[model samples]
Target chain A: MALGLALALLALVLALVLAVAWRGTGLALGPADWAAVRFSLVQAGLSALVSTVLAIPVARALARRRFPGRGALITLMGAPFLLPAVVAVLGLLAIFGRSGLLNRGLEALGLPTVSIYGLHGVVLAHVFLNLPLAVRMILQGWLAIPSERLRLAGSLGFGPSEVFRHLEAPMLREVLPGALVVIMVVCLTSFAVVLTLGGGPAATTIELAIYQAVRFDFDLGRAAGLAGVQLAIGGVAALAAWGLYRPTGFGAGLDRRLEVAAPAGWRLWGDGLVLGAVTLFLTLPLLAVLLRGLPGLAELPAQVLPAALRSVLVALVSTVIATALALTLALESARRPRGLIEAAVTLPLATSGLVLGTGLFLLVQPLATPMVLALPVTVLVNTALSLPYLYRVLLPETRALQADYGRLAESLSLSGWSRLRWLVLPRLARPLGFGAGLAAALSMGDLGVIALFAGEGQATLPLVVGQLAGAYRMEAAAAAALLLVTLSFALFWAFDAGGRRAAA
Target chain B: MLQLDHLTHAQGDFRLTADWSANPGDRIAVIGPSGAGKSTLLAVIAGFLAPTGGAVRWKGHDLGPVAPGQRPVTILFQDQNLFPHLTVAQNLGLGLRPDLRLSPAEQARVEEALARVGLAGLGQRKPAQLSGGQAGRAALARALLRARPVLLLDEPFAALGPALRAEMLALVREVADQTGALVLMVTHDPEDARALGGETVFVGDGRANPPVETGTLLANPPQALQDYLGRK
Candidate 1:
């Protein structure tokens, strides 16, 4: 009953917002809107295509070859996908920004410096965050092609290129579209990467445009107008993707204990070099961020700690709300089995955080006691924003629980609270904890809600870091960024470890 | 102990209708071809499936409305019989009380059950650390701890070697005998039926044959059972 009420409320509010945005301010696609839309699509397309193309070789190598640190490498590939986006942006900036290490080294070498503040910068950051994700997804695809097939190819005296042509190419063809679509969806809703690296009109995305329309101009009409456009574009993409999407069991039992034949000659060297270079490119930026931030840590004072505390508190609240919402939605879907509602729960993935923040601002600002509801509203917005990821993490596990234990629990007369406590909760503990931890970490690193709703006294850690970065307080920003990363990692580690221990 | 009356369930084009009853302490092995709704029958009785037309009664009470976990029943699936992340002790303990807040005697009971399964002192090990036979034993230990009136097995040991399958089957029979629980198992192999030595329920064409003594059924097999087993 409570779940129904929550779902109704969510649906009603979302519907009302959509109606207002639709009728009150019909989508007026001006030249700026057109540019933003086109640029966003182009950028997302390029990011997806590049990420998918690059991930293919890496995924193939990881799937078909083995060596020392193979397990660690596979594990490492999963890390960047989970790392807080803002932290990744900060790390990338510390390495690739104008005054960052790369430019400095280039200057020393008497070469022209590269600017990490344009389309290329946006693409770089997108690739940096998403390449590993694409690789992991595609690697699971490669691994899914039964090892026996590959062994048969080997037994047939197939050379490396022929094997690649027959086995690897088909696998790539099958996996690439899905990986690209997922990446495209990710890039469509991107806010932090564009906000950080995308400078001037040339690189601006629809999400950033939404932020500017609301925060800078306070023009709800234009913001709403752009939001309509955003929704239409996103809705169309989502619909198309949904139509094309085959629900492949990407991660199920892919971790088979299998042996592979060793690569020979240049094949070995080439794979090794590609793997090493990609690893270096991905890890060096974070290392640079850590190194640059260490000296600046001394400059951070008591104020930063309280701001960090505030961030953690807000994150905790948002995480709990988001997890609860996700769990309720997952369980409800399991019971009721609505495909569209399940897809709608993931609609936030297509809507940018900046757009969400804009919607919240427009929704709340007209209220008489908006000030009193600020913190709760902020947390709620964060929860809604992080809802997609929480759903992604929880839904699979929830479905698995339903598949495995639903029968047993039903036979035993367990239902409602008792059933949840005895059967669902115990089995779902690990995934629930993981999802909650992910929500918390994502919320902690989020700057979107704070950008609009946060008062002078309401700054989160990400907001503080953004402020410092905007004001050219690079060192202080670095310190706060590092602190934020550490805090996020610590929260995730604690929750994950706790879940494991509880399961044990 | 359990009764299913005119149980009919249809999904897409497939339909299953079985009317069956089992007395307390009866062990019935359900044997059939793939897609013969052998597992589906167990699932319906276990309350996992709500039949389109039927009624289920357990212990002379209508079980149509009872949820699976609270219906004095337990199911052990093929391989996911034990939660992987949990230690053997924790898995056994969960069968007692999911919260693991057992009384001292209850804890002792779990420990004793673990020992009976030959998993004593290895209760701290996770499912990943266990061999195939050991995991099956651990699953049996969990069922022992549950002490439920009905034990449902969906080919839990079918993947194990013949020796191991026999050992697990014997262990299950032993445990069921001790608890006096009604056991309904689904299997594809005739050898499993021979080892189990229970009443046989052959399901085909969406209907289940009446329960027959295993030895007699094997010695003078019905045409349907012969056809199914021979095809396999």
Candidate 2:
């Protein structure tokens, strides 16, 4: 029944999005639209290349070296991946925006001041968000390298370069392509990041083009055409990436520190410098946001409180729906391995939120004002979007439960609600918490759907921050960005912490 | 009587046959060569697996089509006898109510069962808090509280020391004697078979021969039994 419900929901999204996309079918790409498409490819390709290449050194340093706070640092790496794009953009701008600390320092040093809003800024934000993801993914590959192989290398008196050639190179080769492809697909749907940084016609991405087509141009037909292009591009990438998502080795994966022999001299210094620089690059903007937002916390924008409340409500509602849906869908799929339903739940991974919102706009414009229904639609879409991660988290866990104790439970006559409450729920509390945390944080931090859905004064916090930053209200924008970051991390930490305590 | 009437189980190229019955309260230890159908035979009777061609009758009732829980039998696997996440009381209470919604009277019964297994005043502690031997006792307490007509033990205490195994077997014997429930325990340990002191079934070469008096079977062992015990 849950499978049926989940399939029905997925079918609804696909039907609506496709119907609108197919409403007026012509592959006409105007120069501006072509530029958007070309820019999307160029930026995503460059971002994927730079993030994966840069991650090699950081992940290598991490795998062979165990310093204090190393575990916490690795955990913190996940922050940017889940960090709301609007908040991250603001953080970057706090340091790299026109009068941000970077320009200020450059002026003091008599160097040319560099602005952050442009192609480089967009690429920089992409790398900042995805570099940690790539590092974590490649580090998992390095960790997966059997300790015996490293020991063999050491026994053969192989130094770092030889070791890389003999062992690490092949592992990286196997893992890097999938990581690059996944990040590329993710960036293809990039909207908020590009919207905040990439200004003017030339720098626009296909996703931002779709947004402009609907909002500025009011040309639903062109918007629908761009959406199809996005669907085709993102779908192909996602399909190619379907069977290759073994990064970071999440959820119950025990990544033990391997005792690979560390090289002395030049290599050690090089690794140290790499680690220090990467840490600063990743964390300084965040620190700036915190430092800047603290002063403005007292004199917050009058509208922030209500927007914060609205954001919370949206997150809470979406989290409940996603968790319930994941539990039920996971339970059903556990009994019978329904690959199609699993695929349907994860289909949103390939979707662009702007495309979906545009389709929804087209679907409803004739009947009702899209603005009036924005928040509810945002909640529903966010819930649907979150289903994939939550579903992935729950399915394997529920299957393991059934495998380990299904027979015992059956023989004990522990069926129906009793079986679920006693056996299933208690056993699943940890993954359940983690999945819920993922859902809540993702929903809280998601500026994409709300950007499309929110109308007039119904703006969510991320939207409000983006607006503030755009309007040059840096103090309030920083404060709001800080609030957005805090809300996301706090929700995640609470649920994750709750799960640990319960499981303990 | 719990009866296995010409039961046959097949998986891939392996097949096991059992034609055996034990009267109520009969204690039987199933012994076999490696990969023989000792556990398979028990599984067939426990309703975990269906026989290719046979019926398991408890008293006069055909238990072939019944679910494992609905059947008048309970089985303890090699591990996971108690849910580690559940408290000792909740683990024991599952025997009474799967929902764990115990009445005061049922609650008293759970406490008494806990005491009966030598785990008195430890019902609130979790399985992880208990020692290995104590966990075994807690599992036995649940089995005792379950009080089904038949109890199938699949080397549930194989990890325990020999002294502990003997003690557990003695406790199992006493519990079975008190409840008048038939017991079938599968063990690879030869001393466990002898110390268990029951009618023994020697399963080998795709067949489980009928249970015979333990002392007689050991005194003049069958070829397969000699092959197993002769290893010493």
Scored by TM-score, the top model is 2
TM-score, every prediction: 0.81, 0.94
What's the C-alpha lDDT at position A351 in model 1? Answer: 59
- DockQ for each of the predicted structures, in order? 0.31, 0.74
lDDT by residue for model 2 (A385-413), tens: 88888888888888998888888898899
Which ten contiguous residues of candidate 1 chain B have the minimum total lDDT? Answer: B78-87
Q: What's model 2's lDDT at A289?
A: 91
For model 1, residues A7-61, the per-residue Cα lDDT tens digits are: 6646744763574475336556688778998899999999999998898878877
lDDT of 1 by residue, B120-222 (tens): 8998898899999999898888888889999989998888898888889899899999899999889998778777777989899878877889999988877
Q: What pairs collide in candidate 2?
A: none
Q: Which parts of model 2 have CA positions greater than 4 angstroms off?
A: A24-31, A109-111, A247-258, B59-65, B230-232
How far in Å is the alpha carbon of A305 misplaced in model 1? 2.6
Give the CAPRI class of candidate 2: medium
